[model samples]
Target chain A: MKSRNLPLNKRGFNFEMIMWIFTRLSALAMYTLLLIGFIGALLMGAREQMNFADVMRWAFMPNPSHVINTNIPDIAPWTALFWQLVASALLLVATAHGVHGLVVIADDYIVTSNGRKIVRLISMLMMASTSLIGLYILWTF
Target chain B: MGITRNVGLMTALRYKGQGPMLTFVLHRLGGMGMAVFIAIHMLSSFLGGKGGQFVNAIYEHWSFQLVIFFFVLFHAINGLRITIIDLLPKLLEYQREAIWVEWLVFIPVYGFAVFVIVSTALGSGG
Candidate 1:
């Protein structure tokens, strides 16, 4: 397998191999989604008069009389809708691909059988929670 | 033989590996970075509607975002190269060439992204 560096579980290549394959297959799709989403964000940031840096900024400063609204106007509703769709797809694919990658990494460092299982379980849980949150974020818009 | 042991960060930090090994190492590191970024991204999205201040503060800092962006940029480009090599085993013969191609793509893409971000930051007068 191309993922020769990845450590397979004691059970061998069955499920782990599937995930390794999944990552490979998902790469092109994820790359496209991320690229579009990123470019969309850049354009949207411009429309909103916000820079990429503003998206990273946190809500720490005291609020002035007026609130800081981050939503962009419906300058291009269809484009906005399309990107939301892209984001929704990205949320699912990226989470599954990323969490499995983390599991492969964990398998490398975590020696004991039980320890590996624990790490895998935590990873799955994190994946599920984040997927739900991501979907929720998409649903709101 | 016993199960593999964690080699600790000191050994891991050494860049003594070859080309393929370095790509593998960076891919793993980038994967982990993505995991962390995804977690925070989800959390921030959930809270973003309720409040904007915190998210603004985090995004306002160009330097921090640049680091994160670099990870995503490098990982995506290198990953495409790996996927291509994996799917088309014939390309394996040109592994050295493939690595060169990956770097060529990465450097220009990353450099352009940094240029845009820096320009945006400076333009905003932040």
Candidate 2:
């Protein structure tokens, strides 16, 4: 069989390709964070202290406020800086992954190049604001 | 460049592309649905008062739980299947089988989650 190699520039290094890879990695990252949160909650006695929905809320964000209303005696472990960082990372990753997805879907209906650019720009702005708001709540609350 | 025409919702729904098409459409819808839910959740948490609680109340409803869980579970599983196929091109030939497998995995897990959600709601008199 004959083999041909493409030029270096033709390789998949474009913005879209990077985002494609990012979406996959972010999904994996989220699963990891959720697992860590779930295990940590169980270690904290979530099986007895929290209901399924509350445990899910805690696992999804790992912020102390999410579990304050629960029967957990002490919130100190969950209030640790590590979980805050985890929540922050989740916020950023999920926001970027989701907004990029919206942009990709928008491209299907938006045929014009300019329209795509505008949509991308707006998506970026939305992602940024959402992340900022989420991080603020995660860190301060 | 090829000309593009607007696709009406009814027209798009009437198309008969079958299984793959249904999965593709559901995947897009699921992704969008989750994104919207995330936005609402973040904003509500940020509001942090009666206003926030008001928004939270809506999603806390059992019906909302069913819809959101469906989106999250389906999108996550279908996404994993797509990623596996993408990484291992040999699996591309098994796309239909992959989707069938996806549904096989999806139905039971989703059904169990739904059962739990409903039972919890009813148990709590929701």
Candidate 3:
């Protein structure tokens, strides 16, 4: 079998390569944040105060508004700065990761470079606006 | 680059790639499903009123939960498998075995989640 090396540019860092790395790293980051939220909820007495649904919601996004309607005794702990930051991080990372996935999937159907560029721009705008709205709610509510 | 060709649905379905191909299709679907879910969820949270609650009510249904949970669990596990294989190209030869292991892990976890969701809905008379 003849061993052939991939072109240097193909192997090197580029926009697509960077986004690929971002996708993997962002997945890890999401898992970490989810774990932190889950543990934090448990520490805050989620086992007794919340149902499975509520706990899952908090784990997915630790915003205080998510648990306010639940049986949790006090929303004070959840309304803290740390939880807000964690929720904001989750929102940004998840939105970016998902938007990139959309663009990659779109690339499968979109053949032209101009079409790809349009899809990428739309994806970026969607990611930015979604993150901003989510962050605003996370902080305000 | 080669010219892109469109295959008819029936023709596409006739081609068999077995486990790897099934996983590939499912992974893409799961990712897309979760992406849509996340978008709806964010918008609902942002809406934060009767409008938001209405959207929340839809997803809060047990059936929706079941589907969303399946997407999340499958995507996470399959993604981890892909990442591990990417990091260790030596595992490339064992990809089939890895898919088997992935199913072994996925089925039980997803089964338990479904069981819980169903029981909860029943308990609530939903």
DockQ by candidate, in order: 0.40, 0.47, 0.49
> In terms of lDDT, which candidate is strongest?
3
Chain A TM-score across all models, in listed order? 0.63, 0.88, 0.90
Tens digits of per-residue lDDT, candidate 3, B1-126, equal 234788888989998989999999999999999988888887887776999889999987989989998898889889888877776677888999999999999999788878877987898799
Correct interface contacts retained, every candidate: 0.63, 0.37, 0.37
Q: All predictions: root-mean-square deviation over Cα?
A: 6.7, 2.7, 2.4
What local lDDT does model 2 show for residue A85? 91
Tens digit of per-residue lDDT, candidate 1, span B1-126: 148656877987785778888888788787788778658755875687645547646744778668877787778878899899888876788998898888898888677767867887787696
lDDT to native, each model: 0.68, 0.85, 0.86
Q: Report the error of model 2 at residue B19, Å.
A: 2.6
Q: What lDDT is reached at residue A28 by model 3?
A: 83
Docking class of 1: acceptable
**Leading candidate by TM-score:** 3
Instruction: Say which prediction, candidate 1 or candidate 3, comes out ahead on DockQ.
Output: 3
Give lDDT: candidate 1, residue B102: 89
The residue pairs that clash in candidate 3, if any, are none
Could you say which candidate leads in DockQ? 3
Residue B25 local lDDT, model 3 = 94
Better by TM-score, candidate 2 or 1: 2
A1-141, model 3: which lDDT tens digit per residue? 344488968688698898988888888888899999999999999998877766777887898877887788888999999998898888888888889999989988897888888998899799889888877777777
